[model samples]
Target: MHITLIVPTNGRPSLVSRLLAHLERQTLHPDHVIVSATTPNDIEVRPDISFKVSYVFGDPGLCAQRNRAMALCDGTTDIISFFDDDFVPCDSYLETLSRVFREHPVYAVVTGDLLADGAQGPGLGFDEAVAMLDAYRPSSLPAHVRDHPGAYGCNMSIRAQVIGDLRFDERLPLYGWQEDIDFTSQLRAHGRIVNIGQLWGVHLGAKGGRVNGVRLGYSQIVNPIYLIGKGTMQRWFGIRLICRNLVANTLKSLRPEPYIDRRGRLKGNMIGFAHVLTRRADPEHILKL
Candidate 1:
């Protein structure tokens, strides 16, 4: 299969370099690997290998970068897979991924286990962590939950046709959160998205909420609003739905796990509330990509 792997990173040159090394060793090498970098210097490694790899310079926003990366794959590419800068694909990652996509002919999008690599491996498991956003697990409720499709941009694959000119919704770019949720939701609107049973992408880094604490919180709280405005919230969140999610997240936050910090989330919820009440109509204050 003519597969194109898309990676978008802002300033993590080292991670991208390591990922390129891992890609060089992949048993089934990608036909192409497209990277959207904040600057040209982000891609420091180019292994002497047979697989096609391309790099493009872009500004620092998750969805926008991803959009630029996808542009590299026009109509000819079979599957466009996305990985975060920190991900290191397992040996059989691409090989098994191909099998998953071919196995599920009715599904336009295919995603699988995103195991954490190094010290940041997902202790909660991919299913639990992926559930934090929105996704389709075969054993769960259903393959496609609603007309909206949800996917994990970090390790997700979509058939080019199912998603026409769709790009990451740039408006909710705060801390790069919720963009994938919105993207996946949109995909689900057209066709089903399936989760591969064993395909895995190892994420190498933990949540970098330490750098932009307030903004990280802001993105967390406000992304749902932007998502809802786009009609991608699954219509499952009215006042009651919002309350449920907030309470659930709040409870999850109190766990004090350094990985998922709840203190920033509480502060972010406050900022989010302020924006939702007094700043929703304002352009600068509210989250917009």
Candidate 2:
């Protein structure tokens, strides 16, 4: 099965380079690898690579960059995978995905497990990432493939034909919070979205080329609400997300975590909650806060 890999990045050249290095070791090489950046200078490519590599530039938004990469895929491409620039895939990542798609024709979307520091956080050196992958025992995971609610943007693949005309909702704006939910939820209507426990990768969760904590926090509150208004996310689900983040940020603010910017996020969450209380919360207003 021919595959096209799309990586949307901003200003993290080293991280992107590291991800590419991991892809080089994949047992199943992609027919093409597209690196879509916010600007031409956001990435640098090496002259030598086994597979075809293409670089494209667009406005600096995750959804926008991904849409641009999607447009660049060859017509013959069967599977199109999207991976974050900071994610490090296991050696057999593509091989596992290819096998799964070939075996399960009913699935429209497939996502894998993401490991980071024994938890779901990021930032692993190249050697460390490889070691973790070597140590992971897929046999221990449950054998059954189960239906998933939606695809995780960090490492997910979809049938190229299934996503023929669907594009991410640009209305979600920069960083495009919950854009995966908005996109994959629509894809669910076409076929099953499954989570393959055996297929796993590491999310480096590098703290760069990302928006400030305030903006992320604002989106955390507003994006879900926006999706609810758009009739994509259930109202209760959105409320649950808001409450969860607010409570987490509130608690963390009292005792900040090492990797998280708790204070900034808490301030932003409070601002968002205040806007909601005044009946003035809007996704567009998030930038102004």
Candidate 3:
């Protein structure tokens, strides 16, 4: 199977370059890699890489950049994989994915198990991520696959047949919070969305390039509601999501963590609630904040 790796990145040229170097070590190398970014400076050009690497430009939103990369996949590409710039996959990551897709024809989308995710807490360093990957024994664990409602954005792949004209919704904007779930969940109608344990990776979640706390917080509240209304997200799930974020932010703001802007996020959540109450909440409004 010809797999194309699409990495959508912004404001992290060096990080993306590091990810490319790691990809070179993949047991089953990708047929092509398309790095999508907002501007030329967002990525450093690499002329010495052995594998095929293509760079594309687009608007500054995550969904927009991903859409730009997806446009580059041609007929020869059998699978399209999306990886965040900070994610580090085990050496056999791509190889295992190829095997799974080749053996099972039922799955349309696949997401890997994350050994560690720094996005939930303080970001992890590149060296730390490499150490974690080095410690992992790919052959030690038994392969496991199970049905999933959605795919995580950091390390997910979709069969080309299922992606036929489908695209990430650009309305989410900026960080495109929950855009992964919105995109992969819809593919369930075409085939199964499953999690493959052998396709594991580490998410460094480096904080260098991230949306501001206010914008991100607004997204935490508004994006779920917007997606629910659009029929892309479950109503109960969306409501619980909003409530969880709101409660967490509100309580954490009292003794905010040094790494997070809890107060600002709380303020944004309040703003989102106000807008929602007035029936004027829009995911695009985060751009104005």
Best by TM-score: 3
- As a whole number from 0 to 100, the lDDT of residue 61 in candidate 3 is 91
| 11-100: candidate 1 lDDT, tens digit per residue | 667667767776766779998888888788776866665778888876677778888888778777888888877665566778877776
Indicate whether candidate 1 or candidate 3 has the larger TM-score: 3
Alpha-carbon RMSD to native, per candidate? 6.1, 2.0, 1.2
Model 2: per-residue Cα lDDT over 1-289, one tens digit each: 8899999999888777777777888998988999999877777787667889899997888888999999998789989999988778888889889888988889999988876632234456667877888897777545667786678888889998899799998776677878888888788877999887768888776777767778778888878877888877868878998898888888888987776777888887877777777878776665565
Better of 1 and 2 by lDDT: 2
TM-score of each: 0.78, 0.93, 0.97
Higher-lDDT candidate of 1 and 3: 3
lDDT of 3 by residue, 98-164 (tens): 9989998998999999989998899898889889889877666677888877899999999998888
Q: Any runs in candidate 1 off by more than 4 Å, and if so which? A: 117-149, 207-211, 237-262, 279-289
lDDT of 2 at 215: 76
- Candidate 3, run of 10 with poorest lDDT: 136-145
Error of 2 at 210 (Å): 1.4
TM-score-better candidate, 1 vs 2: 2
Give each model's whole-structure lDDT: 0.66, 0.82, 0.91
User: Which model scores highest in lDDT?
Assistant: 3
* lDDT measured at residue 160 in model 1 versus the true structure, 0 to 100: 73
